[model samples]
Target: MAIFVHLTSAANAARIRRAGLRADSWARTGERGVYCFPVLPSFTVTHQWLRELARRGTRGGGMVAVHLRLDDDEPVLVGHYAGRGKHAARSATAAEAVHRIRELDDPRGWEVFVPRAVTAGEVRRVRAVPQGVGWRYFPGAHGTRPCTCFGCRVRGEYGGRRLRERLPHPLDGPDPKVPVLLERLAAAGEPGDPKEVAEVLYWFARRRRGPVEALIRLTEHPDARIREDLVWAVGGWRSPGVGELLERLAGDPVAEVREAAAQARSDG
Candidate 1:
């Protein structure tokens, strides 16, 4: 079975599992509510989708469908009728779905299909989609649709905070649970998936606060990507000793690491 992801609300995720994707009552006459886009599976893609989900103003938490199956390559579309109408679309790709929607006299009636729920093991923290393993938003259709749904309207709408500022700093407060996150860092040396390890490093590093030895050690990690991310984290801290660390990393053997250090210095 081909697995896909459908990014939506925690509530909507449950609703879809109970009932298959259907037309939104808010949709105009004869319009189907299901939308789907094909996405290449990768860490960057999954990360981007989670970022988009957070931006859409999902306040507390976000949800993603880990396993989804569609009819062949086409996105499943539902119309006012049982499942037959000009509004229903079956394009081989998200881009084609957009093209099909454009051809319609009016495309407002259509909605995207919400995927069925998987076990809780498949779900993850809104901002913390286990590194290389998470759901991806197929950009083909998402790129074209205005998506007035609560999810779309709030995309990239984090008020004053930037999208990257999801986690709290280690020094944020006594009650912010800093020690728990710190323990995650301490446990990084344990054997595990590289992708997952990279994510943990990123989670702490992105906060850019409270320099720790474990984070510095990660800079020497075999994976250039992890090293690059650590450099970014170090650069973000902008503490008294960070400048020296970045200066050393400025000459890192890996071009990516050196480049990342350079960018971080410039940004800092």
Candidate 2:
């Protein structure tokens, strides 16, 4: 038998003790499985996922490590957590997966996926582990510049909003460059790229000051998308004529433009 450990919330310890661990789909690929780490020689390496898993677990719940004993030839899938996908995990026996990971110089992100549920008989014990033992955001993520993109730092995550504000991405940052935005607006004429025009308008919506006259000219642009974007952008401005522009857009022929105008007006 090969020893492995699955870390989960301490709150679920009683249910897990009674019923074992159920296979669940938590990956983007939607593969349902129990994630575990091989019981390697290094104590810290064996329980590396504790901190990250706890961060994603219930806000106040502590964590426990459940040990399992599986047959050496039991089927499993293994790979780095970062490469988890529909086809990225490699098929292997339980023992083979442990052997491959042991050979690695650093197996911080490695994981094993048992496609089926684990039986109560397979569980050896569930013990409390130090909640603060493992890495936080990711392995080796410390001292490195973090990505502030929506995908990297999603809304509502702990400290995500503040982190994005502190280290904002150039394009998606809160502060907008007025001169470049005006240039983009000026060049986005009748034959301009609708996507580019919309992007410029998005930046305008983040700004407190800009050329209101330049934006007013685009209110008559043929593309309803540009007009809709213009409505949203003008909603952020305190300059003269912004209210009138929103009122005009609220009566626009396109339903989407009119809706955007109404929503922006409500938001302002």
Candidate 3:
């Protein structure tokens, strides 16, 4: 199975920065749909950002990038959420692989597949900005993007308030399995406790849809996990409210929570 991933231009730079990339380091997407941001973005809870792609070049299609450092750890999925089996290994010293990446012919643009789970933590290191956003942005068919690019071009039907509204939730049309899971968790759940809420949200992240909006509306979910999960879900929905919601989540106590919060605001 293969997984698809979409990330904004800003995230691509952040991913490299987070990985401790040096001034000379290079970052690019691989064949799979995974993105290899080294730093991940930073944002304000009150002002979540957006995932903006650059203008189209000659190449246009879903792509991925791999940082094949030789002296990292072992093999890992670059885009876990997409379920795409493509992967990259940095089992050798980082110096070795980084050298190889630079020598690739016409590496500027092509169809390259990478690992499954790509996050900032996975990068080795970078000291300065890499040419990520300038050269890379998640592409869609032709010059369109999976986000508003395609939606606006095709005049597609909006998903409606259910995808954006903060209240009542889209209980009628959300995936059926999620509702069942929510019920099971709710039956055994204790409200007001962030732990319970966090646990429930994690389960929801695995599904396509659930009572994610309801969880976001509740002010009681202080657990960064709960907060991140809610924001992530909302962003996945691509509700216009996504930027605002993610901005609110950036203040989470945990860096992981904050990173996830920043992720939700990407240019999608």
Candidate 4:
């Protein structure tokens, strides 16, 4: 058997004890699964997801660690939590997943995905765990400059609004100066510095109104990063031809630019 721990709300403890764990959550690949971490020798590492999960608002009572015993041959998927799309998860048996994680030098952001529900018989015990044992937002995010984008800080999270105000994202901001922004946009054709273009688009995204005609001209900018920023900026614009511009960007050669265009259209 392989030992794994599923961290969840204490409020669900009674039900989990009675009925077992349901595969109620969607994995990165959009597959439904029950996520858990292997029971490593290091207590902190085994429970490292606690703080991040709590920050995601898994509310009820306090948090608890539900230990589970799975047969070595039970099917599962395992991968780094940061991977996206369908290919991120690797197929493995329950035992293989545990062994792979154990071999890693650092398994802080790794997770196991059990595709089927866990029966009550497989649950070993539910115990209280220290709430502050893990990383918040993401692993190694402590010293790095945080991305205050709407997708990152979001709107309603505690202290999110204040943080956005203090250290605004280039694309999501504390507003921008119209004159300075226009000057930069006008000069975009001169040297076409990608950073300057991104900054101009950021201001345009926040301002939502300006010399949109000049902004439209940059749609063909050679730099994909600028084009991505342009797609994001146009989301807030009420100007003419914005929809057409987005449609063109939706097929951008760069995947990130295309994704941004899709998101901008969806948000708009």
The best candidate in terms of lDDT? 4
- lDDT string for model 4 (54-145, tens) is 77565567699999999999999998887667426799999999999999888889999998889999999999988889888788888988
- Which runs in model 4 stand beyond 4 Å of their true positions? 84-87, 173-268
Worst 10 residues of 2 by lDDT: 24-33
lDDT of each: 0.48, 0.79, 0.39, 0.82
Residue by residue across 2-114, what tens digits does model 3's lDDT show?
Answer: 21123333434555445532222112332222333221122111011112233321122322233323224333222212223332333222233333333544222222223
Q: How do the predictions measure up, each by TM-score? A: 0.35, 0.59, 0.36, 0.62
Candidate 1 Cα outliers beyond 4 Å, as residue runs: 1-176, 190-193
Q: Give one digit per residue, the lDDT tens place, for model 1 in 235-261.
A: 767457777777778889998688668
Query: Per-prediction RMSD in angstroms?
Result: 18.5, 11.8, 13.4, 9.3
State, as a TM-score between 0 and 1, how close model 3 is to the true structure. 0.36
In terms of TM-score, which candidate is strongest? 4
Q: What residue runs in model 2 are displaced by over 4 Å at the alpha carbon?
A: 26-30, 84-88, 154-156, 171-268
**Clashing pairs in model 2?**
none
Ranking under TM-score, best-scoring first?
4, 2, 3, 1
Select the stronger candidate by TM-score from 1 and 3.
3
